[model samples]
Target chain A: MSKISRRRFMQISGSLVAAGAIPGAGLLTKSSFAAEPIKLGLLHSLTGTIAIAEAALVEAEKMAIDEINAAGGVLGRMIDPVVADGASDWPTFAEKTKQLLQRDKVAAIVGCYTSASRKAVLPVLKQSKGLLYYPTYYEGQEEDKHVIYTSQEATQSVISAIEWMAKQQGKTFFLVGSDYIYPRTCNKIAKPTVARLGGKVVGEEYAPLGHTEFSSIINKIKAAKPDWIYSTVVGGSNVAFYKQLKAAGLDGGKQKLLSTVVSENEIDGIGKENAVGYYACMGYFQSIKSPENEKFVKAIKAKYGQDRVVGDPMECAYNSVYLWKMAVEKAKSFDVDKVTAASSGIEFSAPEGKVTVHKTNHHVSKKVRIGRARADGQFDIVHESGVIEPNPFPKL
Target chain B: MTFRRGNQAPRRKAVIPAAISIEETFVTFGIFVMQLFNGLSLFTILLLMALGLAIVFGLMGVINMAHGEIMAMGAYTTYLTASFIEHHLPGLMGVYLFIAILLAFAVTFAFGYVLERGFIRWFYHRPLDTLLATWGLSLILQQTYRSVFGAQEVSVPLTTWLSGAWEPTETIQLPLNRIFIVALTILVTLGVWYILHKTRWGLRARAVTQNRAMSSAVGIDTNRVDALIFALGSGLAGIAGSVFTMVGSTNPGTGQLYIVDSFIVVVFGGVASLLGTAASSFLIAQMQTALEYLMSGSMAKVAILLLVITVLYFRPNGLFASKVRA
Candidate 1:
């Protein structure tokens, strides 16, 4: 009814027209075309090392965008996706975010997998007062105004993973990870989390990303004789980690290991024989048997083919886009300022089930699932929490 | 490059696993033996990668950072062959490794030739510039590979021989894939050595490496040899990439992990000397592998690199520079 709202609607509609969402501009001049789609940017490593899992997230985001658009678009306008690859480089991720915001002028961005990368672009997003929807479970120890973390935080992921290991597996845990901000921070948190869970961390070690040898680490684990190996090793390093574990006769069912990041995507590298019986903690698994999840899995397979597998990170990515759409609709506009204010407490039925945005912390209410790797590179969900509010910055 | 630091053997002794009892000595030795085998396995893979990089750096005086991308080309080739075998011939994925090796070589050789003629030819003798340019080219190639192959690593399913572990002792077992890479490395190294020394093409290649201007003056097609040698080098890297899949994952950026060590091998082994490259590959592999067995992977990598730096301090031109010279 107000002039500003009328003009804001027209401006958003004009963008849809420019992006080819509308066939003709004839309706723009008309008095009554109230329906205009919101524009959201999706950025992730589509071609880099993290692509192993990030690719699935990209596809899921696309699928969600298509579904949302088919359902008459978010806020009565088609959801326009501006996709950019981080190329798995930290600086490049920061640069691409600037490009997406300044050049494409997207309202919000959903991107990043690694914490280093998020740290790289955090200042840029914060300074620009832009919203970034990060979808990976991470070693969270920060509270930022510009980012909405739609996945598990450090306390949630590590604490839950440790609780399961302590109760079901063992009290003594050997920790392994690639040396980076996330792994280091995760271990830092694990120290206390393990203590709190009545568990003891027997050994802690780190390897560089893409590292392929694990003999020394295996030997340490063997010597320590821990109840289980709690691994946070990421990327290509994990292949060698699991392989060497198997080669050293320490694979699942023999020498138990519970991984926080290991999922169907990494299992494809570790293979079924090596991954079977290994436990992992995450929010999504291919084995989650819900109607919504079944539809999610079916749609992914239908679009990407039957052999394609979906994982926790992908589901979070999918949910982030939809959550953004929900925020836009609730706000009744695509303006960044309005959406930022409106995003609080916005709820969307994600494949993981109902997720609500934590307005204060910029994290979502996420459930935790502890799954065991089966013989098919798929997971068997063994334990789960009802719903834990996202704890982005756990009290230290 | 064989990084023979004076402190190496002593440091290696420090790595001997602490055995609590006389009975545990056998287990310790078994672990040591497995570490040795692991070193050899890694050596084979690294040798395959470094051989091509050595030739390109030694002969062309260009850094060839895209060497990893060339190897990636081979990896994708292997992926394609595996897919074909899986779909068309079923149960032939094992046999397909041979075909994949050849395909990887052919694709990367042609790619290398094009890269030299189209881009690298102009950037000769400029290591830093070549480094930046080839890095840019690496990005392009990486993007191209990702767009074509999709972002996820396409698993090149190994044959029955390549899968599983060979357990000799209860504690010490050999991964068959590691064994395969080591064996393949030996075969490839011998094959390359034979071509480089025993063949006419190899003679011409050596002549150019010795003195390009003089070789060109003496009725040798030095320019053509440069292109072919570069292509062959790239093809070698491609083979290395193909073999690498047995031990590691092959993604778009997988080539990066090898590039740094490959450079260290080329430079440390007397850039132009294939034998030097081979020896350095083994030594570096042994040191890094032994250290990894003794220390964490990160610390081992740092230790190995420091050893290389120390070696370069003693032998600035590398371990066997004279052999590669006149």
Candidate 2:
């Protein structure tokens, strides 16, 4: 039998009290005063395995809101940001969406990184007629009236990247990804695109999410000797896969490699040296030399830290907030129906570039860029394409 | 479904070899040998991961479900060590691993000692209670790690010496980090075997494990033995975590990836035998590697899990169960 000392009990309770403060902050800011702030939910996974990536997006979202607030928030009212953690679970995403809609009654939500999470939250948004600003690049297979996808779908990102790789890197390609809807659907688009060109998809494989071991996969890759290895391995598993590839003498120098999921943030975790020679396709990179991106980068670094990284997803997440604000101001109301109705054809000169909301579909038209990883945790832009229109349903 | 959407012809069919030639056979044989080397590396990692759980569950009869968090603590220790060395002692960057490895063990050992005194001690003789308590403790520890380290995976810079592989043949390469892990596992396993069998403390610990009341009646400090043994197990896991950063990412939840596999190895080896643990980890690592080489990673995992279930159904006592008068 043992007893927790009073000091220990207080230490535990103190942290619990601190955690209790977040929801209270969201709840207390009801429609009390005449100048009631417009509430927007910033939801993402803040814990669990996916937190390594998604937590950074919350920071980006917050930064966008802060900047908007600093510049005199939309409609002469400050944007009161309500944050929720999805905890890297799909059902939790749905539950959090419902709470943010019903309980908090937030005007709009800019959240979710994985397509699965978007799928989970879709029905809730539909049932409640709530608006969601989803900011992650994903497979293009669906569109909803209640959701505004602020990132590139599969055809915009996948087809262009594969075409570029096929032209420059090699004709024989190998595809690898985490086993999920995004990767599978992306590959489904990729196989046809590779064939459309005079290229061959030499092999394809997927490891489960969070898989750490990849020796045998590397062995198979080495034997196949494909001209280029297209990878979509996600989360912590990417670290193990890249390290093993380097060790097995399959360094990007030996065989060209391009990953859609590996970004500056991932390279930061993977040790830049391991990923330095590889290439990746993304919607944005911190290295993009433009006045808009430069200012956004400066502000982000100032707010976070000197060592903070801006990846594709983070940039898109940052874009999500600004796009939503533009819609709200254009509509001149905080109602979801009014804002969403006035959202189409809204143009924002974002940090990435100029992006325009589609008139028909609720997706953004954004540029696709290919970059080679550098040792300093930044990418060297190798190729940049014109802003491709979002086409969720690409015919093979 | 062959993807011939817009191509001139399927050049793939023309390139397919009619039969396996002699040169291709040699190449296949070479690749097979390289795969076996990979299997050996995987075996070492799994052994290091499982050895600690075996001791706590096997020798102490305490289900330390918080074992993985202890491993995360060690990994974090290593990360902090590297960061400190990089900032304060830039000149000693290459050799910082030696010191980081030691500090990982020390910090986790101390953590384990305090944990046993404060929490696990109360649940002694109640295995199910320890499971529930430790499972809760694991969540708390995970949250603690997240709060302390921040929710992103921190990078541990691998010095140039440990970055690449050792190639003995043109077609075969073994990663240096894996080689280092193999050497570390052997030394740690020997150290553990000696501590449990060659020393006087080992005798008392074994006595306490076999007959706690008798050992207590004969004046063995059963509590002290329990605390030390638990600390030893944690220290072993700490070392495993430190070595893991060379090959994997380190974050608050990094341990969850290996916890289930660690328990599987221990139970499959028979809960009470360290020798059985070594055998089982090797068997599993090789089987998975071999199977993965032939199939997709998810399919290989499914096959291995199903096989383990079948084996366990036949041998519930495990392959090397020992008779102890409890």
Candidate 3:
């Protein structure tokens, strides 16, 4: 009983014409609405002390997501990355993880560079039932249902490297590390392993974190005359330790230094002259020769730039993204429970080599490589192990 | 797995014998000498850092929380100088360090002078306010350094002359950098001593410290003295930063690491007393190095802090309290 106004009639006719122009408009609209992108969280410290190591991981993760999206994404849904900065603070990590899981409703998260930050966010992720893909060689003795460790544990990293060094270098070992949970735990594992390998631990010393003066420790090393120096020193201290070591005539060639933490990224800070001959053991090295690695290294360098060097952490982070996608595709759903269950035994042809998630612990079994640093800031792979099982709680 | 089982039984026995042999006198003597040198090197750096803090906190009665950041400014200056020299005049790289030190001092001096005139002058009488203000200033400076230099730690390349160690004995090898730092500390200390005791500006500064009203009445221009003294203190901190680059890496947060230790040295040395600062630095450094040699680093720090508290409890005024009229 009402007359349609001229503007109202125009609006109604315009919509009607647009709708009629497309066939099956109602069904088409519903299908397009259902094709929303899957949200995934990327939490990393973009600022603060740890950012030096973490920024590269973020870039690598982005690269993996891009690669997956290019290949039509997982289960026909594109990944929508929600990046958050942890700021190198532990509590901030927990807060960001909660926001990512509850607010953003991300299906999965791939982040946390330090053990402290990981431990801080573990409870939150468990409460939310969100999955986290942690990518770093950690001092092990930790396992959680909500997390998957993509890197080597203490057994695969510290124990394996020590045993190899003792066999190759000599029976006398000197242990030095920065005073913190990771280094302390690493030394705790190394101490017993050194004894079991029929080696003598000549000296064990720890400097406060950020402690630069290593003359005393270097002096003790000289006096002890240890055949091999097993170092777990991290951060800025590494530059001072290595430079002072070289200055004090304790070059790797003379003392045979081996570290569990130093990689290609660290060599940039320590300088080629200081780090060149030293040995580092990790799951991945840039110089690793494999079809998978070649493709990965090329893709990362091509995308990020040629000057960007891929380190152990970066490789593991990139692999974690792909592993998550594989698990999601296998599970056939974005539900956290399904993805977590399917995650077990999910194998990815990681840049390092073939890496498979252990059925029970959610830790990946990976090949550990011992690489001698070259003058060009790249590692020369000296020894590569077969697929070593992830032993989070080593009997030692 | 095979080695794990076979090694379990003998591990305990092997550790016990090794632990006993570590107590051998020859090894102990070598360790003692090494720790002493280590302690001396630590003391040298602490003294350089604390000397400036002593002047500012002791004489000015203004709690300068940004003392460490001023030192960081010096370090960054040195870094820039080295980078410039490395790129432009590679042939003069060996002699660049001396020039870098001077530039560090000048840059920090100008910075401190401007800071005092613009911000610090108003909060001189309010210790708590000055503390908060300077703390804020410290953070601002730290962030500024982070933005300008990027957060990653950078190290100055050691000149050819300072690259190696001088080994006097098979058991002892002294790093040339440490020796240089020690020598630099002594020279700076002597220079500071001469300025505070022998110079006209030093007399005016001391007078102002004792009686501000009387000094102003006598035409001393107490304001000028305060600004210059603050600038000098900051310049000394810059020198400390310059020397630190030879031993450690420089970053935005590097200054924060040493600020607490510098304050400890200053307070334990009786605040304004230069001699007290030197003595306390030596004592604390020795205690830390010796304790660290015996126990864990954290435990050593805790033990030394406890010892300092106990010592301070008995002598509330510090190690060498100067007699001054209220």
The chain B TM-scores of all candidates, as shown, are 0.89, 0.92, 0.91
Tens digits of per-residue lDDT for model 3 on A63-129?
Answer: 9999999998889889989999998899999999999999999999999989999999999998999
Give candidate 2 misplaced runs (Cα > 4 Å). A1-34, B1-23
Q: Summarize candidate 1's per-residue lDDT along B1-326 as a digit string, tens digits.
A: 35687648877666664435665776777777777776787777778889898888887777888888888888789888888888999867668899899999898889889888888888877779998999999989888877887776666666666666788877667777777777888888888889889999999988998887889899999778989989989999899888776667777777888898889988888877887888898899889877776677788889988988999999998988865453
* Candidate 2 lDDT over residue span A148-201, tens digit each: 999889899899999998888469988999888878988999999999999998
The DockQ figures for the candidates are 0.37, 0.52, 0.38
- Tell me chain A's TM-score in each of the predictions: 0.89, 0.90, 0.93
User: Global lDDT for candidate 1?
Assistant: 0.81
Q: Is candidate 1 or candidate 3 better by DockQ?
A: 3
- For residues A1-396, what per-residue lDDT tens digits would candidate 1 score against the true structure? 656688889998898778784545557644247655456788888776767667678788889999988988875677789999897789999999998888888889988888878899988897777899999988877778788888888778787788777787468988899888788888888889888878888889988888866766776676678998888888877876776677566778787788888878778766666677889988888898889999999999999899888888888989988888888878887777788778899888878788888868888877889888988898888899878887666664
Worst 10 residues of 2 chain A by lDDT: A26-35
Best by DockQ: 2
Instruction: Give lDDT per model, in order.
Output: 0.81, 0.89, 0.87
- Reference-based lDDT, residue A151, model 3: 92
Q: Return the lDDT, model 2, position B162.
A: 84
The candidate with the higher lDDT, 1 or 3, is 3
Question: Which model scores highest in TM-score?
Answer: 2
The residue pairs that clash in candidate 2, if any, are none
